[model samples]
Target chain A: MSTADNPIAVLVELRDGAVARPTLEALTLARSLGTPVAVWLGTEPDADAVAQLGEFGAAEVRVAAIGAEARYPAKAGAAIAAATEDASLLLVVSTFLNKEIVTRLAVTTGAGVVVDAAGVEFVDGEVEAFQTVFAATWNVRTRIAGKAIVGVRPNTTTASAAEAPGAASIVPISVQLPATRETVTAVEPVAQIEGVPLAEAPVVVSGGRGTGGDYALVTELAELLGGAVGASRDATDEGWISHEHMVGQTGTTVTPALYVACGISGAVHHRGGMQASGTIVAINMDPDAPIFEICDFGVVGSLFDVLPQAIEAVKAHRGA
Target chain B: MRILVTVKFTPDLQSQRSFTDGTVTRTADDGSMNELDENAVEAALQLVEAAGEGEVYALTVGGADAVAAVRKALQLGANHAIHVNDDAVAGSDVFGTAAVLAAAIRKVHDENPLDLVITGMAALDGLTSMLPTALAAELDWSQLTLASSLEVGDGNATIVRHLPDAHETVTAPLPAVVSVTDELNKPRYPNFKLIMAARKAEVMQWSLADLGVDAASVGAGASRTTVVDASPRPPRAHQQIVTDTGNGGNALAAFLIEKGLA
Candidate 1:
């Protein structure tokens, strides 16, 4: 199939009846490759969804329209397969749910999946996916022989408004259903400290073992800056914080605009998760902490002593 | 009841890892069973021990070094081990790996129907977390992934998924695949007796032909994806260090203010 006939498809994910920020970035990335087609799963998007898709340059919006049966993996796979039959490429935000769909799609389509890709480009008529693997230590270029399905890392690109929005026409597509194998019976929201989503937070304030199991200073600083709170594996393992807040190779990988690491020793495991941050600042009492080596600015001091003053300074700056 | 647990032998995470020509530079003797898979082995062992009437089979696919993974599983108390070793299976991606595993599971089910298939959340090397779902799709079975807690009874499996923002309880009928996270259970250490037994126990080996998989459709040539290029990551840039005397915090805050990050 010619590339022109098969447009690049972006799997659109909606939350609270609007396009999620990551989905917008995925749309932006899809438009870079070729004509962008947004694939809406489960329900027909409302007018607002269509406007947002067009703002990101979606020329067409294909709705799979599966009813709410919680057939997350199976239905998602069938929908993506039906939508991207002749598409040049398919893009999805790499979340736990979408990763499963990507795998299933690979099996059903005899295709290959590149997970957690930072970027995608068409090189010499073949799609190349740039992946940062092994704790962000290596940048590998991967290629798929057939139409490629890629799971892009969130926040890899900033979403930009298009000058000439595409005329998006919603087209309903039929899919061959796979047998329902799993269903989400119940969901309980996590009790959060309440700030921006950690993955999308502009600033992240993290504490580690050097905090002496005291997160009071870290939380105060984070809240003062209107940022998210993060913890190291040691802090989480020691019960100082929940696993959900841990930032490391085995935990959540974050790339915020500013990452302020307090009391963290800069272990390789932790570095693997946050090395991609736009700017790094380290605060550690130990002058020889490894984190200082990678920080854009480093402070050799106790977090307990430094955080309070930093919070006050930030407050004063804002007030002034 | 019959159970199958899947394990992968990957390079130790602490070891200096690299890729050669787009493939992992797997060092011999440095590779062992993936740490997360140990949880699956432990979970399987506990389930079989509790029931007292079921057998757990450990399965893995790779070259010669992969036998070490099965041996580790056997040491952890799996009744038998099956190693799918074929030269043609080298460089197979997740889909290819899942295809082989599904075929092997089906071959075993034909002999004695399986009640459950379990795996870890992901392989540390690839970190794709794709095998269980792909296997489910291939076998047309239910998949319950990232379960922090699990229970099996009355022809059904129930799991509690510890998601980032929420906790979800999911249930699926038996003859399903489940992937467990590290928080599920603490893995037990192999006793000396089991260690000795693992060395003496015979490991069954199967080839692509034995599993009825076409080599061309799975191995390097059949691989849907290729590594076009790879290189070592460049070193991080030099950093600016600040010694916090009394004004350190204010200085750091001033920097954030300058960058509009405060």
Candidate 2:
């Protein structure tokens, strides 16, 4: 059992004065381990920000904002190390930015760092992280020997608002980072798309080679559901969609609550990424398609015919 | 200028995957250069060719069969190939792997003074994406990772990272580490002549002893984390398949409604 002195520091990434979805999920998970503390990197947490963190059960908020020149990974690591010195564990979202900072922390302190953890728990008074490895073919339960730093995957669990809000207190920190030779000269944001990002979407509709180079039905179904659109390697390789939409071993690993595989033959390579999804539904012309083997519901028919009607049914049902 | 590009020999993603004890079974499937590392090799080749005066060395660490990774790099036009292998290095975790690679990199730098170290975003088998930063920390060098495009000028490396939501350009001075994503470039296929030549390329082999890596500090026992349990994923059972008799869509919707998804 964790005592009140052992807090769990949750890395809260902010954008335009709002906390990101993954950070809220991290706070939810942190609450399960110990007293939740929000670690904000950009600026002091305002009242609104405190309320946002409080909704997810953060007990305190720690803010560290250095000058632009000293805000690299080393500095971030120093700040986290100093702020969470007595905390039992630190939870960070598994984005590239956070991974770099966590790597630096691991090296600087010789602390064990686990990346892309799908679940974290306190087992027998120790932290046990669940990792999906080998294309999700094998699940590994890992325990870090000493101080633990974990990179939790986005959207692993649904974020739920707590009944009672947390009382927020401000903790300040200062760290002098070594001179960095690296600097960012420019940033070009990706073109805005219609749906939510693939990693964060709760429902995902994906297509593959069976789409025959047309993703019209796939896109329509995804948009109607207010979810993200994904593609298989064959679809992305054939130029039917961007590589970013591909879901497979070489591409993004997703664990959405509902994974709709449209016109996709679930190969081992492709299944490795999405096999961990909560529920799977497959639509394909071939009944023998491997996708049907793992799906909770399977429809063997041409997607061109089935998707249109399915979309209509979904729309009509939601309207009622 | 001298550059070192790191690559890995990974199990073919298409093949059936297996695990022995706590480690993955690599030999069960045919292995090749990690698909993503091919882009790193291509990036390194382009930078060297653009400069018109430099050498690209390829390095890898694994079992004996792992040398195939470096050979593939040679076929892709790397000038030198180095393979670090030893029984003691087996089952090395990412941290231990980083320590060994850092040592080998230090040795190579001692001999030729590398100006840049390039790598793939992540190895397909592990997909950790931790090596580049760990390498940079070990060498105390600047790190510019996940670069989708790269350019070298004025003793510095500039990269445009292709993040999911944004493209970020970062620069690091000489003697830094940069990892490139697959979006950087389309890797080229090795011609027949280069393939045949790569078969005969001299692959320098070194061991833990040569690089001063202690046996006790690496391998499974020394790993900070241990895989406590692993089991075969349970097969999906009792799948309900519906053949579209023109009412298939309604059935699927009904199923969704029953599951509370709609």
Candidate 3:
């Protein structure tokens, strides 16, 4: 609902590898209110993002060439301005680097932003975004009129799961690169946890430290559910599970439809990341475990005692 | 380097929260500077140590409560803390906040030719994590995101970006904005000495008027995005209870069968 008369050009920021799921989701949501125009910030994009962006609903993929080292904020802001010249709303992926990109874009474009959205709807002719805040304690539904931007978590939207051939054309940004004030030395890769990332998965089965280094139950349960596996930071820190699967404040925030927390202590930080789940089920020996307090379904028992049955039920439900 | 490190006072990642209809509510018990921001501070501190001749400046925009956040940044090795306090700055969409921060950056640049602007890739409040990018554009600075490793030599910085299963090393000439991901380094905890040092130092506060901005442009009023409603995601359901007779193997089998898994 931008005040200016123009269709929104969803300014998707797509990177080489890690940016796909978010870009796809952004494209899916963009189809609702505007024509998605994906913006790849770098030299020519990888060959894959082309058709993928278009298939996800991007009508055009805009490219902005900046120094290879320029962080997302500069190029992305330039991309938003570049894309918004003929457009209204700009949709960008919510990431640490792109944050300033969107914020700066808003200032230059005189737009607004709805960020880290879980579910978004075009309600009553305006963009109404469902956001998870306060560790998922509150689900805020918001809307914006006039020109605006939306910063979305990766994998929040469900794409058609198909790729279409896309054409990526370079759009040169007039703005020159800013004099950088920070110096980067290097980047080391963290050991990635196994399974699909929480933000990208439809189903997830998680375990707390209660597993006592025995993830057999959680793994079996996740397999039965046909879902990815996740864990509490306690499990990861305890070496019972890896940080890759840890779901907490320092870890990944998940907005899945179904989230199963097993033997978790349910620290608030952990909940902050998982509270946006549609259906949360917790299984712990102590009913008082914090995880159960926020769960949509709480089972007061050892996970060792319950997951088998739940897996069975799920298998039956799936007719597997 | 004359670096500027920006940090945000954020609600404790562990704090339980609920929102009123269409409005998100938070308590005064907000927690630490987001862990990632702490890393930014650490990066700034480390850079200062490496540069040997530069001062570190911590910049922030928030109410009085955020004084703690700026102070923490000071404790991490920042020489000075600057608070941009303006009611107009509240509810600033990333763009508005960036505008004010841009003003602050311009102010800092005007005062002491800045060589670098550093920030966490994103704060725990978990918004669109796009602020760094915007700031870089506004300042027209070279930028780096998700820098995993960093080295400064001969007035140039060589940093590595952590991509999936691999890394990309890139070099940036001096005076750049870098939005560092948490992977860059673990932020060190502030010792008691630094904590007291932070207390002794004055944190300079500036208002919208100080930043030379109009009040109407910031916060929810000028924001294109508005909270329409807020509701706690419904409470979890009472789960079905299941127990075992100390024989996990046998019990597990029976349990699965009862649920029709077997």
Candidate 4:
């Protein structure tokens, strides 16, 4: 295996019968590269997982080089090195643990690595990566030529519904797994917020400081639209919503198909995270709130007053 | 149960960072070394604290000011300190940053080969977060990242790494990489003694050539990532400042009507 091939490799981050939404977006970005392949490690790559990935346009999905372990993130890197052999660049979803794996892979392969990319694309026949930085204060665009790896931020781009039957074949690369002085025997999922992960939800209804702890209207509106609920950092920090539901610089970055903000005064930090949303609808008492700047559709109102009517109208439209 | 951690000196992230005449201004106060870096230092300290008897060493790459960050790690209870500094190493990005740290790690390992190399998931200033990965690559080590929690036992590292909105616990063998997240632990403050000791201790500095790195590969040239256009996002034109009075529900209604939401 030589570096001449230089195909892009996406390190898959899948768990418990589901592919992470970011992985889907990475696969979408991977399509721009000549032939995109994924190195699935830890858990076995299954049919359902492969199917969902296919819909996202992966040209290939390779099995990881190492087995599940009590303490190893190197498997993804090792797997990418083994599977993509000649890949010039590698893309991994940023997690606290896998940074080491990608780092090690970059070292073994001598490739440069970038982390927390808000957007990654093929720019002028070169791979350019974007980072949403400074507490979501600014957007920094960068690229490292020759060989590099990038850890992409979530929800920067929507996964394409385009289908590509990636190579589903699994291969066990022969490599010595590193020795660990520690071990974890069991793992469990954390408690999820009432709303689903905003990145995966096609529709997200978020509130800002303006909501005044009155999610009543937002919930009704979200329920009416069959969407998840979110909050700006101001709302979450103010305890109007949980930290998990907070969407902003330190929180989740979502590019849902539809995002409706209620009572959010829209700080640049909050907008940095949600500006990618396809259709933005805002409802605030102030017509000049920053939320209005990015919103494609808006209604200025006391959420308390307009929400009930809006839900009723939606319900009436659904005939329930 | 001894753990050694590494920290980097970077531009303050929370501060409004602006380059004046191609040089960073100190008008911006020092934020945490970097969130990811803090996460890494915190992770190592946690493991040592959990073990009860082990010592922790925290190292940094930079000028005298970096000692402040190193002292921070010390105040947090790092048992040892190694400051890798010098003029030759200035302006190194991740690759150069990795090289300097690798030398320091080798020296520290010679004293005691660490069971783990913990780093922040990524530096907010670099935003590349490649140091941990690059260092691990240089060391040919295993790694786990975005760790919400990390457990060290049986010569292995197990952690709950965040992916998307969910958290997954993963285990990697020893001599591995552990880059962590701020969600993992709240960093403890340094006591007066450790902070004082950090002041007295010397940080070893290395030049770019001494690290066996090509000057072209680091700093302005070696860095693959470049900022082509940097600008403050234009302020929003529609900054509606609405004060909610107790009876403004009606006012809010009228305002909504004015905006056509009513």
Which one wins on DockQ? Answer: 2
> What's the DockQ of model 3?
0.31
Between candidates 1 and 3, the one scoring higher on lDDT is 1
Model 3 CA lDDT for position A288: 65
Model 3, residue A83: what's the lDDT? 48
TM-score of 3: 0.77
Stretches off by above 4 angstroms in model 3 are: A1-87, A90-108, A122-125, A152-197, A212-216, A235-244, A285-287, A299-320, B13-32, B50-53, B75-77, B163-166, B214-221, B237-262
Ranking by TM-score: 2, 1, 3, 4
Ranking by DockQ: 2, 1, 3, 4
lDDT of 2 by residue, A86-161 (tens): 7768999887778888888888777788888998988887788987777666788888877888899878866876
Error of 2 at B199 (Å): 2.7
* Candidate 4 chain B weakest lDDT stretch, 10 residues: B19-28
Ranking by lDDT: 1, 2, 3, 4
TM-score for all predictions? 0.92, 0.93, 0.77, 0.72
Candidate 1 matches the true fold with a TM-score of 0.92
Top candidate on lDDT is 1
- For model 3 the local lDDT of residue A269 reads 69
What C-alpha lDDT do the candidate models reach, one value each?
Answer: 0.85, 0.83, 0.68, 0.65
- Candidate 2: regions farther than 4 A off: A1-4, A67-71, A191-195, A208-216, A233-244, A249-251, A265-269, A286-290
Q: A153-269 in candidate 3: lDDT tens per residue?
A: 766777764344345344545445544444434445555546665556777788877898898988997776567888887787788765567776556777777777888878876
Question: Which residues of candidate 1, in runs, are more than 4 Å off?
Answer: A1-6, A189-193, A223-226, A266-269, A286-294, A315-320, B241-247, B254-262
In candidate 3, what are the lDDT values of residues B25-88, reduced to their tens digit? Answer: 4344766566678888888888888777888888888877778788888777789899997766
